[model samples]
Target: MAKKLIAESAAAPESFEQAMAELAQLVTQMEAGQLPLEASVAAYARGSELVRYCAAQLEKVESQVKVLEGDMLKPFAADGAGEGMQ
Candidate 1:
């Protein structure tokens, strides 16, 4: 079980979207209560790893956005008219 989790985490998704899709699938499987105890534990561990990876990716993107915005993070406008817009 540990080996499988390690392998899966090592592979890690290439993109945040891919990771999120896999995590969603894992959540659905776990919620169904069909997996045995060991399998469930493994899935939980993998899901945790995915969560961390997704968060890190988000933070990286946010940092890039801040840099593009001159280090000033602005609130997004719901109507799509925000900073840098005429």
Candidate 2:
């Protein structure tokens, strides 16, 4: 039963936000030290999957942004214009 639950949770999240939320919840549960050893191990595995999913999503977005910018990704200028742009 526990294995089944863990396997179901291991499914990929619908989006990055969902993955992050699930990962945070898992961390909280693990930190509380309430789960049995087997459950804790399962949670750790699921957390790893979430982390990978989030990273892949971020990477995909970044690549898309780079292409949109003509593959010229530059440092962000909070002031809207850097000194050299003048």
Which candidate has the top score in lDDT?
2
lDDT of 1 by residue, 1-86 (tens): 43364456657789999999988888887898877788888888888989999999999999999999999987778556775866
Query: Candidate 2's residue-wise lDDT over 1-86, tens digit each?
Result: 54565677777799999899889888988898878899989999999989989999999999999999999887787666676876
Quote the positional error of residue 45 for candidate 1 in Å.
0.3
TM for every model, in the order presented, reads 0.78, 0.80
For TM-score, the strongest prediction is 2
Error of 2 at 82 (Å): 8.2
TM-score of candidate 2 versus the correct structure, residues matched by position: 0.80
Per-candidate clashes come to 0, 0
Q: Stretches of candidate 2 above 4 Å error?
A: 1-8, 78-86
TM-score of 1: 0.78
Count of clashing pairs, candidate 1: 0
